[model samples]
Target chain A: MRGAGNRYVFWAVALAAALAAPLALTNNYQLGVAHQALIFALLATGYNLLLGFTGLVSFGHIALFAIGAYASAILVVTFGAPFLVGVGAAAIIAGLVGVVIAMPALRIKGHYLTLLTLALGEVIRLLIRSMESLTHGSQGFSGIPRPEIFGMSFRAGVPLYYLLLFALVLGVAFVWRIEATRYGRAFKAVRDSEIGAEVCGVRTDHVKVLAFGVSAVFAGVAGSLYAHTMRFISPEFFSLGLTITLLAMVLIGGRGTVIGPIVGAILLISLPEWLRFVKDYYLILFGLAIWLCAIALPDGLAGAAARLLQARNSVRGRASLRT
Target chain B: MVELLSVRDVGKTFGGLKALDGVSFGLAKGEVLGLVGPNGSGKSTMINVLSGVYRPDGGDVRLDGRSLVGAKPSAIAAAGLSRTFQNLQIFGGLSVRENVLVGRDCRLRSGMLGGVFGLGGSLREEREAKSLAADLLEKVGLARFVDAPPSMLSYGQRRLLEVARALAADPKVLMLDEPCAGQSQAEADALAVLIRALAKTGIAVIVIEHNMRFVMNLVDRIVALNFGRKIAEGTPEAIRGDEAVIEAYLGRRGHAERR
Candidate 1:
């Protein structure tokens, strides 16, 4: 298929899948799993901004996500603020922290930068855990309010699912818009070659810092939604594992492509849950899957699939010539 | 003629090695100056220091008589100085159009949120940039390759794209490091014509090159260096006949001036 044909097929499949998902998932328990998968989709898209487009693999993106969630949760539960205000606050807090982190981290590159971001994320998590008085620490924060639209609270599983879907759509559209602009060009330039980007008069440092700030805002917004959807907040939920899973999603989806992260998140998040039947060896299978995916397809599943399609077409041409 | 860029006694040392020892030169508007030197002659290092990759250990640099000694690379770029690298640092993964658009970083009027929100002005700016990029690609004779990625192009084509990328900045002064280093004689001759044309448009050009025949034919003035020091500066014909430059070339065959 060409151009819009592939898009039409993709959307048709996506809509069909979305519609069929709720039918198969009859209980709230299954719905919760679906909701978490959607949340991961949002976070994975944000993570890809740094890891894929900008070529900056950050291991501490979860810090920004947690910061956003905590900020919004505290504002709504403790201060009686509006839900939208909490969302805005989450973005601001995450962006501010992102800038702080970028200031020092931007000076470094490659694995060292990754290590620095990981350590920073751990520090933020530890700080949240130690702030027993403010954050409720180990006990966590509960009673976080649901998002209110037109004075109606999204309290149930189905309503929450649609709300999160709307968030995902808006987030995806935002990413789409950015990918077409000069900012996206700058980010890709930095990703491909820092020295080349600089010589071309790109302010690489500014591009990098801006990418981190934007990625943080997305992650923060996702965190706010995650908190409200769960109606609870805790340090345990914002673990390094979530960051690792999101990173895996980005790599599995094809980092620089639009739908890659979403596909990655949905598949990776749901596959482990589905393997619950093999409860004892579920993790072993998960680990094997990740290893297999990495070894067989370094560009991720989306990349591998595209290559396979191309290869098949080429082989068809060769066979036709031989005949 | 008005001086567009002036380097006054700029010097740098990496520990014990004095890569640049009190180098000074000035470029006037629309002038084409050639920097020629031997191996370890500090040609590339001089470009690096002037372009803000390396801070000068002594003295200062001035663009339009404004001090730029301690400015960062980005700040220097924003001040209207743009350059190309010897190694052809074009983004291999991006299309030629996208690479050229990156050159317009300082010229972009869009804000971060403006792009994110798809504001009217930002979108308009983007459309304008696309057309501008097309024009730049045409000027560099890479119009057909606009949609093609840099990796698909030949080395000579990549060099032209690198020049085009610098031109996309719409800079007041263009500092090209060995723009013709790896091209054939025919390509080098074409580049000389392009360089001359660019200089005629009032963009001061400082070209560091090894092709003596090309530089001698195109540049108005020649600045030569040997062992991190300025050895000769005069008209191209005068430097072509200079014994010091001849000796430096003899000292390192194909290495010093090639890169």
Candidate 2:
């Protein structure tokens, strides 16, 4: 197992590199894509708490994302709330909804739970489309005011980038801290064997609900950031396709590892843009690539990297023993 | 010693078939009792009912005189009962030490927010839990495999890991379901020694097994069951001489020959 100190150093270096990205990439469009990738990373990391650690597969995460966006948007636009209040409300609302979904989901699992979440995502999307008075329906919510932090407007460009980057770092660190606790062990235990977890004194239902709620909080925060960054929102933005992409990010990056989802988000987000040369066929190629990765690396990219690292460490230990 | 766990007229049924029929037993503190029976004789079902996996159809299960009839498995576990499954229930993905850490979760006082934030108290508790897990692993002779996953351990080692995990709970009543089913004779002997040592620590033990020799040699007393009914109960020596137990195990001819 990786020590706490090593994990801290790894995150610190990664955060520093993220902070320095703007200096090298001066293009506004690239920065925008980078910011979106970071948001997706936050979403993926949160989703992994359920999918990877807790062994839950939710197809309704996009519903949580939509709920977060709509809740924050409604709070700021309709209620004229402060930006920070909107951000906090977004997370709280999504987490509450997560608990509601978890009540039924926890009672049933596997394919049944997946179908339930799928229906939930569709229901949320349809609800948003039908509520034209609040969400402006298909016309979408526009002119969402830029967030202000102590008189500094984060409307676009580097300031907005840094604001999102900070949130992502905090989100990652929060999850990392959770992984080091007894509660974290409970989540893993439940994932491995519900009966074993129960006999070991873990309340499996509570653990599952907490996993869903925490995962939704991450998506909510990401959604809030997305709303402010785009200065617009639409029901179309939170589609079942978006949920599938997030699932792909977690699976390809390697589930159950702290760095896996982030790695997955970055690669999946950038892969499409890099393949733009192929134009219309790029999506098909992307799908094929994901398929290949799934088949070739059953443990995902992170698991492969972990195995390689272990191999290298053992070799070094053997060489030292020879001396 | 006072009774630590009590089962009175407990019964369980699946559809039309009775799995356990009005079974009654009391386990005193520091006592080691063996539950032996043929296949489908309700030994495992009794463990399940007592552990709260199954609610007894008719009767009561109590820990220290408090009824645990309708409680959940986790609640029963919190009430100071820990059990191992007949087929290994080890977490295959987690390290051996991590598995023991999970067992200590019930006794830990930190809440979800505190754990997520890594508050000073929570961090200290985690550190203490890790050390305790290490100690338990050492007791079970699995200290060298602390960092290894369950998949890496041999079958016998995994069995010991399960016992170590249950012991980590510091339970008042420990239940072992067929713990020596597939073990080598040597491994089974080691496990016997460990179980006896655990009982000496003042914890009541219930060993459910089909291995007659192993159970007979390890337990102070024995309870025999056949077709969901108790056939006999007595000291290990008395159980060996009991005509009903002989009939239950061997056949009607074995009882006739004794007569």
Best by TM-score: 2
lDDT of 2 by residue, B76-105 (tens): 888999999888898877899999988888
Candidate 2: give the clashing pairs.
Answer: none
Candidate 1, residues B137-207: lDDT per residue as tens digits? Answer: 89888899988778778888888888887887788888989888778888888888899899999999999
Model 1: lDDT of residue A249: 91
TM-score of each candidate's B chain against the true B chain:
0.93, 0.96
Worst 10 residues of 1 chain A by lDDT: A1-10
Q: Which stretches of candidate 1 lie over 4 Å from their true place?
A: A1-5, A8-16, A306-323, B251-259
Tell me the deviation in Å of residue B116 in model 1: 3.0
- TM-scores for all candidates: the values are 0.92, 0.96
Local lDDT at A278 for model 2: 93
